[model samples]
Target chain A: MAWTAPMIDEVTCGMEVNMYFPAED
Target chain B: MTGAAPAAEAPPIDGSARPFLPRGVRLKFCEVRKSWFLLAPERALKLDQTGVAVLQAVDGERDFDAITAHLAAAFNAPHDRIAADAGRFLAALIARRMVETA
Candidate 1:
């Protein structure tokens, strides 16, 4: 085992989430 | 004009020397993920199966020859090829300060 540990979770605040849908031509 | 800076000295690694991870570098096996990772202060590196096999052989006791022999036997590959590849891999790590001679 040479590499480091795996990430468990992340916490963030005041962040915006955007969603996009596929548009037909 | 300023003179060019001298090149950093490369860590010594040869068939006769043993290589190990130094103080700043960390090695760990993740039980949940069943994977090995190497961590430095600035970055984390994922090791492939072959990389894991090679690093596991670097116990600071065995020389390159012994390590190569072990790997060749373990994988049923040609000894010379393993020797060359493992030597180069360890040497590169030594250059990066990830592996050190003992």
Candidate 2:
């Protein structure tokens, strides 16, 4: 497939929370 | 971190507009910093050091993978984490219309 710029698509809440859990704790 | 503040929504852009975001990446808004931010419509994200790099790399030419790799090498953080974080941020950005999916 051809290359494309990173467009804001899809939501990953698991990943998001995983990333910020430490900071919050 | 200096004069650079967050980007706010513009009428020129077609997308949702709001102040608070819905992404999972948590952030502490530094009121002292006085930053203005705009999430990509349909996208939600919080900018940390890596997120900032992702933003800088965004010339509408690179994908999330590219940004993740760049940040990985630049910060020496785990590749998996960077990719995951980038994915999450990208999701948020998409939701806000700050970026559009290809």
Candidate 3:
């Protein structure tokens, strides 16, 4: 099989995460 | 207090260095994209099919030369060409902390 050189590209995306926490008194 | 971030150590790409993926870095196939990716913490790298093949050959036991030979044989390509390309690719990954050399 003929082969081509490998290439890598960075994938950049914005990510968001939601967290729930107990209230501190 | 905050300090300067540590520099990334340069990896050996002199054909004698053995390369491997570090902890928390993984090569995976994306069903949605139908492509391969190098997934690391907080980051992802899209890879072409050739990239997948090259990465699959990295076992940490194979030095750069061995890896090149394996790839060249499998692809029926020239060893020098594969060596040049694979060496550069691995070096890039090393700089990004996705791959390490032992």
Candidate 4:
């Protein structure tokens, strides 16, 4: 897809934050 | 370190229009990391030296031809070679919304 302002927003939105959780014993 | 994105966009560029970095976009050097990055409000990118130079050349006034010339002279390369390389790089930047035509 051609890059545009909306695409920037899409890409940014797709940037997910990850939180690590320790495994239960 | 991760390098800049590949030069993939091959658009027909108009040489007369100025190619500039949008005001909201930021190109910065990280002293601690010893690397360069292109940062927007929500995203940050790792950039190589050449990527830094490309962003630095866009001054909101120079056209594609002028920018190509500058890079050519800086690297002591031929105009045709620089033109093609710069064109591809700038095209990718344009696609990424990092550079704008003015």
Of 2 and 3, which scores higher on lDDT? 3
Q: Local distance difference test, per candidate?
A: 0.60, 0.45, 0.74, 0.63
Pairs of colliding residues, candidate 3: none
Docking class of 1: incorrect
lDDT of 4 by residue, B1-102 (tens): 133246775685787879887866777665756767666556565565656676688888889888878877776777777677677777877887877898
Interface RMSD (Å) of candidate 2: 12.4
lDDT of 1 by residue, B5-77 (tens): 2223344346788788887676666565576755554544556667778888888899888988898888888
Candidate 1 regions exceeding 4 Å error are A1-25, B1-13, B31-34
TM-score of chain B of 2: 0.53
For all predicted structures, in order, the TM-scores are 0.65, 0.45, 0.80, 0.73
Q: Tell me how far the alpha carbon of residue B100 in candidate 4 is from the true structure, in angstroms, after superposition.
A: 0.4
lDDT of 1 by residue, A1-25 (tens): 2222112111111121001111112
Write one digit per residue (lDDT tens) for candidate 2, span B1-102: 223233332333212222222343233343544432233332234454545556665554555566667777877778776665556555555545455544
Question: Which wins on TM-score, candidate 1 or candidate 3?
Answer: 3
Candidate 1 residue B25 C-alpha distance from true site, Å:
2.0
Model 2 misplaced stretches (Cα beyond 4 Å): A1-25, B1-36, B39-46
Off by over 4 Å in 4: A1-25, B1-5
| Clashes per candidate, residues 3 or more apart or on different chains | 6, 20, 0, 0
Q: What is the TM-score of chain A in candidate 2?
A: 0.33
